[model samples]
Target: MSNQQPPRRFTPMSQFATDYPVLLIDSDAPLRELHNCVSERLNAALKYLHLMACTSLPDYAENDINTVTNIARILVQDVSDVFRVIEPRGFETLKSQ
Candidate 1:
């Protein structure tokens, strides 16, 4: 007697979304405007960080620390807004047209 084994076939499951949520971009604003907003906020944060007077750690006062933290918060909000609108690389179709 000869024994023959059957090949198995499998079906793929639907994709599941990641659990993390992002701060949503404003629907009323155009994409160009959103881009400008994100860029400007990031620029503002960088400008404050580059303040020459605060070059050394000892130069930072309590108010300076608060200002730096507030700038960081602004940057986070801007980034979260951006991530809300973009899709994962492989999951999206690449179009050249």
Candidate 2:
């Protein structure tokens, strides 16, 4: 007998559908607006939470609101930009179409 491996047969699984349609939705403008709104809200909430938490500390100062707000805004912007850049496929698709 010849030493040869049997040919592999390719078969499609019944449970899986190969040609399922992909529905691409366009909502970039709304999504960006929502993201901006949520980000601003979250940053404001965080600033308030930080200020509240700081109030409980011994060295808390009421004059630090500007500094805290500035820092929080910077952090929020950086995080927002990072998120936008990393997952920009949706935005790109929206722009292209």
Candidate 3:
């Protein structure tokens, strides 16, 4: 049988699009790998957030602003990608197994 599945989806605020499209997490991947990916993306998102926090000044050049915006778009895309696999339901369902 074919193994393909439909894309998972997310909504972002009206201000951004990814610099490159972010692919959905592969649910069939090893759980350990998924945890690694979640950690990576969350760390990257945190980095972008920290950088954005520094961009609020009145004298920065346009490229600095664009750099933050572009990465923010990518961060949004990546976080959206990661959250798809974070098991929104509590682990009680797993304990039952």
Candidate 4:
């Protein structure tokens, strides 16, 4: 008898269209959720950065300028935090398959 293993099957989302298009719809829900969450966080960061930029006026005192610079730095750290939270592990799974 042959010792070969059976071929593995990959299920594409389109296959759920018959009686369960809902599965396809539900499958996209996680992506949409992540998109919305990330967009909101990034927009908040941008708003904070915009406030800092606006405050960095030519006539600003040294302390005020320093504060604005610190805010910009904090926003950069916040963006990095968001990326760490949302980064996916699916690429490794695809490679293994």
Q: For model 4, state the Cα shift of residue 66 in Å.
A: 1.5
User: Residue pairs in steric clash, candidate 4?
Assistant: none
Question: Model 2 reaches what TM-score against the true structure?
Answer: 0.33
How far does residue 43 in candidate 3 sit from its true spot (Å)? 1.2
Residue-by-residue lDDT tens digits, candidate 2, 1-89 = 99898532221222222465232222234557646654775678587667666675546566676666666665565455435433564
Across residues 69-96, which tens digit of lDDT does each residue of candidate 3 receive? 7876776666655555556422535877
TM-score of each: 0.48, 0.33, 0.55, 0.43
Q: Model 2 scores what on Cα lDDT?
A: 0.53
Candidate 3 worst ten-residue window by lDDT? 7-16
Top candidate on TM-score is 3
lDDT of 4 by residue, 1-97 (tens): 9999853222123322276522222222354564565577578778877776676377788898788767666545544543443454334447789
The true-versus-predicted C-alpha distance at residue 4 of model 4, in Å, is 30
Q: Name model 3 segments beyond 4 Å from true.
A: 1-24, 86-95
How far off is residue 15 in model 4, in Å? 46
- In model 1, the runs with Cα more than 4 Å from the true position are 1-24, 52-54, 86-96
Minimum summed lDDT over a 10-residue window in model 4 is located at 8-17
Q: Write the per-residue lDDT of candidate 1 for residues 14-75, one digit (tens) a residue.
A: 22244543334544445567567767777876776677346786777989778777767767
- Scored by Cα lDDT, where does model 1 land? 0.55
